[model samples]
Target: MSEEHNSRTAAPASAPEKVSLWQKFRRWPLIARIATFGCGGFLALFILAVVGGACLAIMDPEGTEERAQQAEDDRAEQEEQEEADRQAEEEAEREADEQRQAEAEREAEEEREREEAEAEAERLEGMAEVPGVEGMPADEARDALEDLGFSVDFETDTEGGVWDASNWVAVSTDPDSGELIEDDSDVVVNVTRPEDEEAEEEDDEELAQEEAEEEQSDFTITQEGGDGWSETTVEFDIADNFTMNMIRNGARRDTLEAIEEALEEHPDSTRIVIEGSFPMTDQYGNTEDSVILRVFYDRETVDQINFDNVMVRDTIWEIRDGGMIHPELQE
Candidate 1:
């Protein structure tokens, strides 16, 4: 009995200890336990998701959005540069083509002009080169040819117009001295008067005529033209040892008038040669007075020198049609 009483007294003390310690937990709620378990599960899931996301970010694809954007920008810049270069090249090519075209046009124009000039020259030369045309008087022919851009060399035995003997001339074209000229070249003419007869009777007759006619006189100058050649001749009287200045103005005037008439009749197409003779008087004593008989024509240069180096005659030169003429006195 005593033991049972002691046990009962100890039991009360233990009960208070148990109630205080378990009081809050027992208040409990089934709802609190369920909520705790749910919260714990949710925290575990959230931690797992965060770790997985970090791993996925580190192992991203080879072509990232940032890298793709950078590549696109680089490509665009390259394209822009290439386009600029291509445009510049095109512009340069176009300019070069234009320049070439202009040059070609200019060359063509020059060639055309050159050909025309050559043709004109050829026409005139052909007319001058005809043989057997020597019979034509040179003075009248020269005037006709000069209208066509020919340069003339003339010498007359008589004071151009009416005289005892007829005048004669030798004609040539440019490049008279050396190599032949092209077929188309202008005629150069040379004319000279016939020598006065050397016979004593002739001299006396001339003196008597001179005494009778106080003033110098001349016959008319005449001209004739054919296919390409023209003839001019004048009849005149002249004294021996007379200078050009000494020749009476009336005689010269008559010859000039006739020559002018011939030129008026003939235009640029034909070649003319003036033929005549003149007695040269060297009052200066620097030269000898002699008869200078020649054909006056356009060209005057000579390759070979003959007969007293007289510009009037005794030398031969080239003329129109690239022909050569060696002057010889009429038989």
Candidate 2:
């Protein structure tokens, strides 16, 4: 066993063979070998470039710093470009939003104007201008208003005694012509009779005046006293059965004549009190005499009043019971 061991030792013992990377690469498939070689080549080039760059930096410090500065500047420039792009996008979006808002407002204004125009058009549809009727005859004015689908109302002017529309002339209209009104509106025609025509009935008026004078002689002074004539009050009695012409004249005319006679009789009287009454039957046929007229007129108020023309009740100082028969008097 010693001789065998000496023989094994005499022959050089062979070390185990190590496999090289080149040989291992040679044993790989064609595609894997190409991929491995390409990867290894790139890695070797990268290592060489790194070692060479280190050597260059050590040899040329200024060039190394210039290259680093250039890289930093490129990075900063890229960031600035990105920021500019982002800001431009934001500004474009804001402008678009503003434009949309402006368009919406314009549309809303256009709609409102259209609605208003339509409303105005509707308002002016069936309206007509009121025609001039003043200074025209009452009947002619009424016909003209009726022709245009308008109802006519006649109002008598002060000093107007004639009730016939054909005999009167229109003084004015309520709407006063040339005003826009509905076609179906009411038009008031104020009319009056000419004074020259009233004078034409002088004979009849003179006869009536003679009769009034005859009637005034019957008005007896019932009572007369007040502060020793400084402010004298005169009360007169009027006939109850007195009538002024059957249908042509009013009963108030006799009462007015009685008042005038009292004033003439008591010129210095401050107040003239005249009262007259007629028998009134109620629904139950109970007949009783109630004071239907009372007149309290001061001398100053009577001076301003026109006794010949019908005195307006409101124009008088104080009047009660069956007020004035004038057209302008309210109830």
Candidate 3:
């Protein structure tokens, strides 16, 4: 009975009960126990995270690669959106600039049109219609133009200008008849002497008598007798080169009578002469005189000549020779 009890006690000693993990932890010191619980918790969390990751990978094999591609695609789309916005901004700025340029051009065109209109209006203000002066006397034409607030300029067609403008007629006008001209503009009246109507009235007998009289003497005098007869005396001693030239140029007894009358008006005046000048244009664009005719007059014995019903061919001397001679007529 003693041996049986000893054996039972030895069996109980040899197999002291194995401590559980919780019992072992509880047996440690306070700090050690806390450290062991924390370590165990961290290890369990790590194992659970690894197992969850493996399970997700097994469910969708290409999930990580697809996520990476989606991220890359999103980044590319954001960049494209920024580029589009920039392009749109640039286009808007360009359109605005073009619109501004077009507006400026339109404004400039309007201003030019306005200026042109103003100029046209101003031009029309100072304008007038030129009056018809053709076939009118020079004085009448001058009066007509002056009445319309225009100055008159005279141009003569005949080589020997008229001594009096009233004796001439206007053939035409510069700027023409029935045309528009500026206010106070110069109107040029082209004048010419009227045709000699009496020249056509000379019959053949009168012409033959005139030829016979010219052939008779350079100068002639007639005296009437009491018996209805006339005595004619021809004087060749009074004939001079100048008088012969005057006769050759169609001057008659009336021309000498007219010169004599002019001399009678100014008996004290010396060196009476008739002069005619024509305008000539030089190579240097200068207007100059070309003397056409010249005739010297004498006062003595001029009244002895009869000049009834005759035509004078030239004008008498009006001014002195120095006043009448042009620079081109000088020696």
lDDT of each: 0.50, 0.70, 0.63
Regarding TM-score, does 1 or 3 come out ahead?
3
In model 2, which regions exceed 4 Å deviation?
1-36, 129-173, 176-179, 187-331
User: For candidate 1, what is the lDDT?
Assistant: 0.50
Q: Write the per-residue lDDT of candidate 3 for residues 141-205, one digit (tens) a residue.
A: 89999888899888875576666878888888898988888878998888876764234346666
lDDT of 2 at 116: 99
**Candidate with maximal lDDT:** 2
The deviation in Å at residue 15 for candidate 3 is 27
Query: Please, what are the lDDT tens digits per residue for candidate 1 over residues 1-331?
Result: 9899989877754344445635765677889868877999999999888877666656764545567788999999999999999999999999999999999999999999899999987765644432222434665565554554455554443465433222554434333534343434555544444344235458898999988886533433556657755655443433333544344333333333433344455433243343334444456755443333323333122212232333423122222223222232222
Q: What local lDDT does model 2 show for residue 28?
A: 91
**How do the residues 64-155 of candidate 2 rate in per-residue lDDT, one tens digit apiece?**
99999999999999999999999999999999999999999999999999999999889968777778887788889899989988888888
Tell how far residue 285 is off in model 2, in angstroms.
84
Candidate 2 local lDDT, residue 96: 100
Clashing pairs in 3: none
**What's the lDDT for residue 25 in model 1?**
55
Order of models, best TM-score first: 2, 3, 1
